[model samples]
Target: MRLQDLFINEDLSIKDAIRKLDETAKKILLVTEDKKLKGIITDGDIRRWILKNGDLNQSVSLVMNTSPKFVYEKDVIHAKEILKDKMIEAMPVLNDKEEVMDIIFWNERFSTKFNQQTLENPVVIMAGGKGTRLEPYTKIIPKPLIPIGDTPIVERIINRFNEYGCNEYYMTVNYKKNMIRAYFDDMEKSYSVDYVEEDKPLGTAGSLYLLKDQLKETFFVSNCDILIEGNYSDMMKYHKENNNKITLISSLVHYTVPYGVIVIDEDGSVKEMKEKPEYDYLVNTGMYILEPECLKDVPEDTFFHITDLINKYIDEGEKIGVYPVSESAWLDMGQFKEMENMMEKLGVK
Candidate 1:
């Protein structure tokens, strides 16, 4: 992609910057002042800003990284070296006057042959939940095997990862493990599927320790029943760029209450009453990017959820980040009601 294509005005609001970044599918945005390079705003920067302050109207300059590493028009060789040495997806190409120019993508030049190379990172899917909310259906067909369209919900999750070049998967199974295995075994899949049987139902992150010795790089872990429409490549870029041990893919969920909400003052006086107040919240979409070293903390052979792991890391001051996506991009198929809603929204019978 061209640098000019990725450039955003420094005066643009945080919300606009996010929208543009999502639309462009580029992790870094060139911040320009009167068509001149001012700084670079990355998805990580935006996320960190949001975490620090929930202000969306702030200017991009507040979160942008000034003095970003860049390459001049005549420094193509040096640019490639910097990109490779830094292990970055793309580098901004600038002019002598520090004006926005273009971008040089690493994948477009090198790693072309390996373009078809299945991403080696193992994706650990937490599919052991009993899914009591979906009761009768969960009792028969495992939650992972519940159909969304023509394929099971878990298959869709796997396919979404595969689209971003991930192929190896480790499914943690306990409830109806055989059924889940049988379903996948019967189907012709494009990627490899390996199951880690939990003798007892291990909550989310508990079973991840089973693959501790196997993973040497950052890997993705997700719940089998939620579908999030965001660029995995961008998410990975944000993960590496921020040097985070764990990066959670979050969605901005909005809820509107139909009834009026009353606000009282300190003296019990009515301050105000707002009818049908709408609220926005950031929720974990059950998708994550985790570094290999972090897996060492997963206690062996126990029941623990990923949330517990996150809390542990946060308590220790380890960096954990969240990348926010719009609600329309996330589809939860974990419950009967959500499944019905998703089917209706997706127009899938």
Candidate 2:
């Protein structure tokens, strides 16, 4: 990997810094000025910044870690020890003049990350909805079986989880359930996918009631149409450490208004005028890490959506948690345009 690819200007906007992080897919960026390492920023830094509702337009220097761990050129052999001791993915090598000479990546196999993570947690996928968004195509085939490249979107989602050693899967099935079952049954797989038959269209959380007796531990629940790229083990760690009843795996989505907007008072006077503004939100990625006990709250056999469950917890003064990922880390395929964009993003035909 090119060390230059991970370099970013210290004054770059947080919004653009996220873009650079996504472009490099390195989970980190080196903040440099005149080839001198000024600081370092990671996706974790950006997530924390967004949580505080910090302006995305703010410079990355505000969120970067100024005293980042590094190794000097003469101590190149110690780079491994520093990286290992700090548990960081990479370390910058500095010359006598404090110039960034190169970067030493802890994970030499850069094709993937967290090779040491092994998750025993089971995954539950909500795949029973009648996907009306895909239009005429859904009239014939199920959304879970809808192909992106040569593989279905659901398979891509599973493939991602599979990398972390999650082998057991439970899928809630209703519409075109047989097709979904047949496809996986006939194909070769390393993991086991069990079916949780939904007699009707059980809104997201309703079908989960069926798994109450089986899932005695913390498990993953995901919608059928989206994919997220991140460290699942780290997310699991956050979930357990926080003792959260439910953790929403949200993405920081940036929505830009196309036209100039005007803010008006009730008297019809323009209060404020601004150019096209971009809004950043922690959007629900239709995925969650849930404790099994939360399933008891789901109304039995009713069309209870996940939002209803989350709202119930909120109303009872229960604290829910959110794990935010970068905008590019989330790939959603709910609508036609989103499906096309996801395909394009994945470089799939």
Top candidate (TM-score): 2
Q: Write the per-residue lDDT of candidate 1 for residues 2-76, one digit (tens) a residue.
A: 556787888898878877776676667888776687788876686677777567777887888887877888887
Best by the lDDT measure: 2
Model 2, position 336: C-alpha lDDT score = 92
Q: Which residue runs of candidate 2 sit more than 4 Å off their true CA positions?
A: 77-82, 107-115
lDDT of residue 96 for candidate 1? 82
TM-score between candidate 2 and the true structure: 0.93
Models 1 onward score TM values of 0.71, 0.93
Candidate 1 residue pairs in clash (backbone atoms < 3 Å): 3-102, 3-103
C-alpha lDDT of all candidate models, in order: 0.82, 0.90
Q: Which runs in model 1 stand beyond 4 Å of their true positions?
A: 1-54, 57-118
